[model samples]
Target: MTRLRMGMIGGGPGAFIGPVHRFAAELDREIELVAGVFSSDPGRSKAAAGAYRIDPARAYGSLAEMFTTERARADGIDFVAVVTPNHNHLPSARAALQAGLPVICDKPLTATLDEAHALAAVVRESGLPFAVTHTYSGYPLVREARARVAAGAVGTVRKVVVEYPQGWLAGEASGKQAEWRVDPARSGLGGCIGDIGVHAFQLAEFITGLEVTELLADLGAVVPGRALDDDCTVLLRFANGARGVLLASQIEVGELNGLRIRLYGDRGGLLWRQEQPNTLTLHTLDGRTEIVHAGGPQLGPDALSRTRTPTGHPEGYLEAFANLYRDFAAVLRGEQAPLLPGIGTGLRGMAFIATAVEASRAKAGWVKLSV
Candidate 1:
């Protein structure tokens, strides 16, 4: 199959997630970055494109220019990756879709629930493939956990506990990433919930195949002079009669990307940690436990398809991120690919963020999800 051409928006100089997106998109060599508007500033956009060795002609000053110019070219981008900050996600994605290109976006879909719903409507009207990069869901072991739960290997999912904690924002800082995340105008209604909390929420749902029906949340701005929450905890009720607890914090004092999820069912239970992503622990009701490793015999075809290495070889964050790009590329190439989080997941995540904020303001009382 021919390599699919791709373009990017954002991930310019000193940006964290932009480079991660570049690495992940090219990891499997199935897609190539042929065009981009790397930043809002024209100079930085040109420089970033030069650094990536993209043709200067393909580097544009803005998303509008990029979409218009690329669509007119004989060799246009197959899809556009929206790696901008949360505030720009909706506009950039809408532009790409309106230009008749597919989109791969970072979560939580948009800066607000209203924008998310509008974007979702555009996606449905356009009938193009749209993927939301819920990075953890792309892990082979995570897929295994999902498949196992779906097959009743853990009986019926009864409870879920997911937490993502980081200490980077524990104190007052003035970095670009930290600044925008704490600004309500840029990051939307919920801060911590919109940032890492959505990932924890999505992981629980993705693994257990359950939808959150109601939730109560406590959101905190642990650092001084912060306008948005940096720590949050939520109690969730699922449609399948299961219950869940979610905690996402950037003020844990000594944590570093520590994301972990545990699911309990009637017959058994399972645990997975982002720090130790290659392994999953399965526990039986009789006090027996088994350690399942990635690229091992126990994984089903779905997990194996996403795994790249042998039993002992390791795969981590970048690989998981690439798996989403890989599946999107497969879909573009007319190959059957496993389901990836898309517009629906993105919409739900935004709804969760909005609902959590509302619930927190009401003294953490329970609130039903509007979506």
Candidate 2:
């Protein structure tokens, strides 16, 4: 089969997730970055086309132009990747879907719940394969954990604890990533909550197969004079009488992407951590603990399918991200990618962000989550 072509929005020079999307989408040789309006500025967009090794003529100054010109070409992009900030997600993705192309968008769907609703409507109306990059769910072992939980490896999940801590923004925040994230207008109603908090929330539900029905939130801007939240702790109530706690913070002292989740049920528990992406620990009520490696034996079909190397090899963030892209490519080919996150994930993420931020703002005792 011919390789799929990708058009990117945002993630221009010095952008973090932009290059990440580029790297991951091409890692499996299933997709190629052929065109993009890398930056809103015409000059920067042209420069990025050269950096991406595509013809400068394909680099348009606006989303409209990119979609219009590309569709008129026989070699147009097969899909679009929206790697911009929270606000740009709706317009970029909407344009792609309206033009009869699929989309792979960054997390937090949109800057507001209303935008997510609008985008979700457009997605449903377009009838295309729309994916959202919730990165952790792409890990092989995390998929293993999900499979185990689903197959009754853990009986009746009762409690879940997920935490993501980063010290990068603990001090006075700077840099392109820091500046936009802390800005309310660009980052939406939250900073840390809309950013990594949604990741924790999404993973908790993704693995346990339960929905967060209600939450009590405590969000704060720990750094002095910061506008948006940098620290958040949310108490959760699940649909199946399960209780959960989601803690996402960018103001921790020495933590670096310290994302970990533990789920305990009547019979046993499952634990996975991002720092050690290859290992998943299974604990029993009798204190028996088993270590499950990424490429180890006895893994479920879903986990094994997502694995790249043999046992003892490492597959980190980029590989996890690539798993999504690879599976998405198959999806674009009309295959079922059960583990791939989609528009529903984006809708729930926006709900989670809006609900958590509003609850914290009002100090509401326990607000029901509508996701």
| TM-score between candidate 1 and the true structure | 0.98
Which candidate achieves the best TM-score against the true structure?
2
Q: RMSD in angstroms, all models?
A: 1.1, 0.9
Q: TM-score for each prediction?
A: 0.98, 0.98
Which residue pairs overlap in candidate 2's backbone? none
lDDT per residue for candidate 1 within 238-335, as digits (tens), equals: 99989999999999999999999999999999999999999999999999999999999879998999999999899999999999999999878777
Supply every candidate's count of residue pairs whose N, Cα or C atoms clash at under 3 angstroms: 0, 0
Per-residue alpha-carbon lDDT of candidate 2 for residues 16-112, written as tens digits (9 for 90 to 100) = 9988999999999989999999998988998888777889998889999999999999999999999998988898899889989999999989999
In Å, residue 313's CA in model 2 sits off its true spot by 0.9
Whole-model lDDT, candidate 2?
0.92
Would you list the clashing residue pairs of candidate 1? none
Candidate lDDT (C-alpha), each: 0.91, 0.92
